[model samples]
Target: MTTEHLDGNALAGPLGEIFAVDVTTCTGRCASCGLTTPVASLHVYGPEPGLVARCPGCDEVVLRLVRAPGAAWLDLRGTVCLRVNLPD
Candidate 1:
């Protein structure tokens, strides 16, 4: 799929201020899957604030969020972008 997503620095971006996830589940599609699943499980281990967690399904990292922000904006590097309101 797209490799534009940051690996480690992602956690340092707006995501570092995120709150948390309600659930973690596998969706089976690498392109369609959300990084939130493995991130919710805390399956990834990283000492650095900028750390990457691998997706359980694709074995490729889907990035990780540390603080779980209240306002999250997603940028596809050079593609489309989105700003989402995170749950409280």
Candidate 2:
């Protein structure tokens, strides 16, 4: 079976809320592949229970975010680190 997917741009809004920055332009290192790339280049799936972002290099789940009524959860286990250039 084929699962539908979208680019990381879809996550910009939700991630912006959590990061308070433009995450789509940020770079992230994939823990599984050790590859560094722009977050906006990753693959994104779902607005169902939450949003899932996967690495384009190794297909590893790089990030997962869930927003509840009064709470929110963010997982970055699959990402080693993220590089964001904060504005001056």
Candidate 3:
């Protein structure tokens, strides 16, 4: 089966609920290919089982978010670092 995906901007709503700032603006480094880019540039798929964001450069899974009844799970193992901008 073919899987269609969206840009990481789709994660704005969900991620906004958990983070104080806009996560889409954050820069992420892929652990696999060492590619670094804005989270908004990553490709995102799914919202049913959860959301998975993959690196655009190497197509490696960069981030994963799963929401349950009262809890949420986020996996960033594929990302070495996430640089989020903060107000001074």
Worst 10 residues of 2 by lDDT: 1-10
Task: List the candidate 3 regions with Cα displacement exceeding 4 Å.
Answer: none
How many clashes would you count in candidate 1?
6
Q: Write the per-residue lDDT of candidate 1 for residues 1-88, one digit (tens) a residue.
A: 3333433333433443443422232221233344333233322445344344555555554444343335444322221222334458
Cand. 3 Cα-lDDT: 0.93
RMSD of each: 9.2, 1.3, 1.0
Whole-model alpha-carbon lDDT for candidate 1: 0.37
Clashes of each: 6, 0, 0
Q: Give the TM-score (vs. native) of candidate 1.
A: 0.33
- Candidate 1 residue spans exceeding 4 A from truth: 1-16, 19-29, 32-38, 64-88
The best candidate by lDDT is: 3
Per-residue CA lDDT of candidate 2, range 1-88, in tens? 1277899999888887778789899999999989999999998988878989999988889999898887789999999999998989
Ranking by TM-score: 3, 2, 1
lDDT of each: 0.37, 0.89, 0.93
Per-model TM-score on C-alpha atoms: 0.33, 0.91, 0.95
Arranged by lDDT, best first: 3, 2, 1
